[model samples]
Target: MTAPDPWAGILDPGETVLWQGRPDTRPQWAMLSPQRLTLGVVFIVAAALWGWQSAGLASAGGAMALLPWLAVPLLAVGLFNLAGHVLWDAFRRRCTWYTLTNRRAFIATDIPFRGKRLKSYPINRETILSFDESEPASIGFAFEPVPMKRSTRMKMVGFERIADGQTVFALMRGVQGKIERDFPIDPESLPR
Candidate 1:
């Protein structure tokens, strides 16, 4: 079965499907609101103006007249920021991932241009569903109480508002239920 799109509720569900950790499947444009880029552009423009005014050179006036040239850096910075934000969003979505197949639950992390770490818990071994809802959500899977044994924890930083955090949690619960039913393990009994 195919997975649902993460942003289906926000965008055109039919047209917008998640790439499932595939970089090529991510949105071409930034996932962040354009307002962020607009703010960056404004700041860059202001900085350029300040620099132009402070130079106090006759040639600076000619340079100021060329606003388009001055805007080049601002535009570049804005685009770069936008791209970075998009990449960040894509990375978060990819990292905050859970796959439930007939066999087991597959959890993984994707670091753009870098390597990824993936782990699978046989339907029986996966006993716990734990997460941190702090400013940055930290999702993980563990079978032991010791903190170090739990390698499923994914560090998801910079995501202010998760697209559908509740739904994701619900899905995780459902998966946990399935694991419990199929396996004779008590999730709570597992070490922290």
Candidate 2:
């Protein structure tokens, strides 16, 4: 009796819909990962150390040797980490979207010159919720008992820099409440 849901196909057969929205198209690089910031810092430090060392070596090898063989690569690594990541983060924000259903939460992204990808996480009573109350808010999700290696681990998902963030987060909380009320764990089922 209403317009067809764009995300209806990805949902489960009996899943109830909660909320759906596209992330703002504004480019945002401030949300880039901590690892990216660390990488940039490491490169900058490397350039400083190598440049100082190469300067000392210049007296022995001459100015030509230092510039070509040493200083260039150091500068390149530093520039790549700083500028490259900002560009990547901006591109990702532009292509991201978010959806919430009673059964799960989903994020769909399509990077420029790269393909699209969709990831969904089932919502349960135990799923963690963290948020920022700034202008355009952010909600982040993380599941526990993770793998040791960060690269191999499941990264936390987020709805980034979107309007009405608090409203969306409240919807998530309501869905979680419904899950808990419908399927409360029984103490008798556990081994005593």
Candidate 1 lDDT over 1-192, as tens digits, reads 989954344333223222122212254363566787777677677657855665555455765556535546665676556566676665566554544443344556666666676655543334455565743343444453333565544442221233444444455566567556766776799799
Error of 1 at 47 (Å): 4.4
lDDT of residue 102 for candidate 2: 85
Q: lDDT of each prediction vs. the true structure?
A: 0.51, 0.75
**How much lDDT does candidate 1 score?**
0.51
lDDT of 2 at 49: 80
Candidate 1 residue runs with Cα over 4 Å from true position: 1-24, 28-34, 50-77, 80-84, 87-104, 110-114, 119-177, 182-192
For all predicted structures, in order, the TM-scores are: 0.34, 0.63
What value does the lDDT take at residue 68 in candidate 2? 34
**What TM-score does candidate 2 get on C-alpha atoms?**
0.63
Candidate 2 Cα outliers beyond 4 Å, as residue runs: 1-9, 24-76, 143-154, 185-192
For candidate 2, the C-alpha RMSD (Å) to the true structure equals: 6.2
